[model samples]
Target chain A: MNAIAETVMLDSASTSVTNAVVMDCRIEKIFYGDFLAVRDSRVPIKKNKIIGFIGPSGCGKSTVLRSLNRMNDLIPIFRFEGKVTYHGQDIYDRKVDPVVVRRYIGMVFQQPNPFSMSIFDNVAFGLRLNRFKGDLSERVEQALRGAALWNEVKDKLKNSGLSLSGGQQQRLCIARAIATEPDMLLMDEPCSALDPIATRKVEELMLELKEKYTIAIVTHNMQQAMRVADTTAFFAVDISQGSRTGYLVEMGATRQIFEQPQQQLTREYVRGEFS
Target chain B: MNDSHLSAESILQAVAGDAPRNLQRAPLEIRTLKSGALTALTWVMAVLASIPLFSVIYMLLVEGGSRLDWEALTALPPSAFEAGGGFGNAIIGTLVMVGIATLISVPIGILASVYLAILDPNSKLAQTARFLAKVLTGFPSILAGVFVYATMVVTMKSYSALAGGMALAVLMLPTVILAAEQAMMMVPKKMKDAAFGMGCTRTQVIWNVVLPTGMPGILTGVMLAVAGAAGESAPLLFTALFSNYYLSSLTEPTASLSILIFNFSGMPYDNQIELAWAASLVLVLIVLVLNVVARFVGRQKF
Candidate 1:
């Protein structure tokens, strides 16, 4: 219904998105019921880059990431003021469907939650949901190949997606997200459940995926953000009033955020000195 | 004997004692004795609870077993002055009416439950639907019969199998909806969230994730409802009335196992009494099979 937003979305599809903002969350506030979960300032996710959000336990890294795709809208109490635009179209706009927003912005959860369906079906799920007109098996293979899991799971594509190892299941989830051809991917602590070797594999996959799609990741592991993120946003909890609230402390090139963080909180967090 | 994640040294320091062996593994302590006494009491009470059920089964076997023959299952019932016969027509009619009830109830119950439990659970309308469904579960079967009698039977101007089924469907709908709502609710939020994240609409999530995962439990509820419907005579009394002949049309009078038993048990003739006993055996056997089937269905076979 917003004519300007619709035209911008259409125009962006044809134009080069180099240095362009694919998704932006310039929110004034994020609320879950009455609690101020995130006192949001501007946190724009740029095109074709992995932006890793890192913070303490209560800090709203995942909240910001979820808001990017309007995934927070699924939570009954989740309410936000201000724009979360995908391709310059305000996703929270009354007419902009969250279902459509999600199709363009995929998410991989903290846990490797493969549907109870088979591996091939799991990858094909999104495409099927969108009624994809392509050769489904080929797209599933391509996505699986893209996630660097094709060789391991290609032979047993018919098996339950849950039948794979934890690492492979995570990769299968990656394949599933990409098969829908989303312009971006959001991962929430994707490697927390994995071993060091598996974590390394996922980290590698993220760097590879950044070439084709924008990525926003929330991670507890600072070293992981250092490894994979092009830009890193450090969030910190403000506990001055007894009730805690998370806010973006600093967002810069990953190196600067790690080596020369502008904020004292960022410095303390990266140095593992949380008081 | 051995240690894994928590080494023996850590375990010794953590427990400061003999571990699981130290943790109340006494053979004859007073607390242990009390637990054993309670366990014995539980088993006794369980057996006590089973007594009535087993006794009824025993009574059916002793009183009804003799007349449960091939002819009693496949042949038409005898006339009032006749000697020996079967209630095959009754069996057919019962199956047909229950089939209709199931057809009516299953979809409506499942869809309405999805609305109540999944879509708008906290809404006032959903709350009212839930409350009404619970109330209906406790509703008297005779009341259901009366409702159908006014709405269906009087309008149709004939005691028909369709009317009987409508009455049974009313009785069944509440049970199916409640059980199914609970079943759908029990599907993990994680699974649904995954579906939603994959760009599925709410309807898609319910159809693709919620229903499949909740299916075994839903089937159990359905089978229970079916068993309950099959055993009701009061609902069929005014709605279906009775038919001694084979059910030719769904719009005509029908005979059910419950009604046959109800009718023949009060008859003066010995043959009719024997036929009633045989019918009771059949009905009990049907309910027993349904319970067994429900168990198998309830298990996560997938």
Candidate 2:
């Protein structure tokens, strides 16, 4: 275990020289009031890379994803031990504001939740909230283009965001997230509600977006993880004596985790032997 | 082979003089009968409920129609036993008093409701405020009048339009707060989550997202409060009293349609009585128009 830690530290130290470490999460445990939700986890999200979290239902993948950006702080009962650092600053420190953390680490939810406003307003919402001083129309256009939705929606910018199709709405949500220019994006099952074609589009968009922002996504679809993620973490729930608590099983390069998993549980998971 | 087996099974059933026992059951005629009876009953009940409304409207049109005229609408009430007068001053007075009341109550009510629905919704103070608002909705309109009479009219040393407006404001506040809170609460939680996810401050989310989304419903609440305030006669009696002339200032006693109807309805003169009916018709029309406007506004999408 010490050797493994040494190796991981060496690997991270070498990677930090070339690529920025956007978020370094060392979550000892997470609790919803008195109930423990997630056990220990250690994951370092690299800059400009897609990191996928694959786990079965109730394995706390989304919980860990949310905690990275302090999105879990919205729930009054939620509390976590240990530290989450963004750009070498402890985000969970007393002086740190969760709102500020969220501004820097934007999130996209499972279901596409576009505000009931014009398409332009939906993309411009985050920018407006942050009081973006740049040219608003140009910024909105840039965001829509970044999400690959500008051509389809440019003519109907005045129309309601809800008027868009399911796939387009998800892309709009992505545009809304990126408009604020956050350094990292946390997506929790973003493609779960979308169709296959929409899922493909989103996967392609994720690849394109990884050039500019770090992304951490939690998904149930292992194939999606294999397709889009550079790094993958497998999570599993321990239901010993009926006390269910989620813990990280393994983390490695996507191909290594899928093809030559170091952990037996990860191998079983990748083999589709058991959820 | 399948057809031969089916024919054999049919032959066996025919020999038994009844179709296979598990194959089918008798049709449910009772369901159709009960549904038909219930649908007819619902129609009958609906018609019965509408009868009183239609009858009141019919009475208003028949009794007040003869008194209505261009002059009646644009003139002040004549002396007792005199003819060819209207409640024009009363109409203007109602508008002024209700308008003032709306202006006072709407901002207070909407802001209070936003506090209850969005800010510190579970706090002890908000819970108390919510309970008080619910209790206030059932407060007697006459008591509202008396409240204004004591606080404004008595302090100022006379019944005035300002006092009347204050009384109506009190009556309207609770309704607006309750309805506005409900409307704001009806905004989906997911929308709020989305707003908050974008790192919007609580105030920004409420103002930019929640309020706009809930505007139609809030407008309906405001319109309903205005309609209720417009038709209130008991509250105006102590605060507004009665006036025969056009309103000079808010400090002076004002004429309202409800007050005019109340005062003239009891007079022995036929012309005064007819004028009272005319005022009642006008008051009803105003309330009806307000309700219709509420529906129209409520139907609008954000």
Candidate 3:
């Protein structure tokens, strides 16, 4: 009976977690010192699929995204009780190096934060960090091409990464991430700082990138989730205890969550009905 | 039972049809005059603040301008009873000792600050070191000389250039460390985050991202510390003592511009007094150049 119950539970998640290769992990809790920030998030990211996390402001979507690659470890007060695994290995294990985890699961932040280096150097940073023995120029070119920033930036590879347009700089950052050949990419609202044209370009890039790398993005735009995501997770704030903490309300196919959500909160959010 | 809706035009609300017009403010001239008064007050205070600085420059130029010759910089200091000699050795000594002090303090200060501001900033030891650095910034310079006099001077069994440099290094450390910490802290969190997200180790982040980004500010701090160390006389008084001739080695007594002025100002000879003024001018110029360079370096974008 317990085995049947577990099978039903796994089926309910809808992403079908039977494939045990990559991005099969769950987050139990994230804390800032003693206060619980986010809890019980169970959207196991799948391979070669783009998953979008959509929520209102301060709903811990970004926080959840940050925890995936162990980026939250940079904060001294940040604490976590979670199993974030990659390739069937628990990343938060004591023996695992956060640096190595970061290398394998690359991230792009909200702001276009290209290091203060030439465009070529920006892309080459990750490659150099891993001490890649391949042809560096060829690798940088491939990463830039993969990010769709090659045609515009190929001529000015020596220019500072900051000299590019905001969208270009973000693309440059993406190039920087994939240069190390990470299997998964975590992007935290990568287009919030950009304009409409740039946003469109980035959305297209994400669709193309899904052919190769698993992607999880946190976004404020519901239309964005509909446009690009294969699956979507809705995070909502819980304030019953006079404190705001975020929890995942539902995770399902993007169309199902938008059209016929299982939870009332998800329904209200999709309809833009709740305050 | 009394939950009646109150609409805009209900309950004898009689004045609801008119649109809101432009609001009146204070008369334009009165407002302008008030702003002008504030501006004038600031200008007056600014002039008042600059009076002492300008007066000092004027005094220095009048007293030392004519006496500042090539000879004053290239010749040895005049004796108590003699005339027409210069502090060539003192200029060389000041540069050498200040160089030594800079070499000793900058690396240590920058590393300590990296620990305080970047690596393990919240640890009890870092907090204590930060506090101690702040306290030492206010500690008396004479005490630094006295402390060095007890340690290096006593152990080396002589008053030497090395001792004076050590004394200045003691005074320069806190300034360098504190200023460097502020600079490192000012490096954008995003840049460091980007570097870390790129899989940089802590040391790699410091070396590649933090240090290079903070270089302008760090250089500014180091230059300011060097200026402060250059102008200090009390620290060198006991540690380096004074010499009339050129330094033979790092172990012998050294002559510095500040010490030269100190020794010459007390002499009864007119030429010695004039040389003192000249040395003061050079010292002031050195400090000014260092400050200007700090501003220049600090203003760089990357």
True contacts kept of each: 0.57, 0.61, 0.59
lDDT (10s digit) by residue, model 2, range B1-302: 99999999899878997666675543567887788889999999999999999998899899998888888888988987676889899999999999999999999999999999988799999999999989999999999999899899999999999999999999999999998999999998878888888887788889989998898889888988998999999999999998999899999999999989888889999998888888888988988887787788666453
Q: What is the C-alpha RMSD of each candidate to the true structure, in Å?
A: 4.4, 5.8, 7.5
Q: Please state the error at residue A196 of candidate 3 in Å.
A: 1.4
- Which candidate, 2 or 3, would have the higher DockQ against the true structure? 2
Per-residue C-alpha lDDT of model 1 across residues B1-302, encoded as one tens digit per residue: 56564696677778766545466588699998999999999999999999999998898898889989999998888888997799999998888899899999999999999998899999999999999999999999999999999999899899999999999999999999999999999987877888889888998999988998898889988988999999999999999999989988989999999999998999999999999988998998987787787777666633
Give me the TM-scores of chain B across the candidates: 0.88, 0.89, 0.87
Best by lDDT: 2
Runs in model 2 deviating more than 4 A are A1-18, B1-28, B291-299
When candidate 1 is compared with the true two-chain complex, its DockQ is 0.55
Clash statistics: count for each candidate: 0, 0, 0
After the best TM-score superposition of candidate 3, give how far the Cα of residue B198 lies from its true spot, in angstroms.
1.4
Candidate order (TM-score): 2, 1, 3
Every candidate's DockQ is 0.55, 0.57, 0.47
Docking model 1 quality class? medium
lDDT of 2 by residue, A205-252 (tens): 999999878899999999999999999999999998487899999998
Please, what are the lDDT tens digits per residue for candidate 3 over residues B80-172?
A: 777688989998899899999999999999999999999888899999999999999999999999999999999999999999999999999
**What TM-score quantifies how close candidate 1 is to the native fold?**
0.88
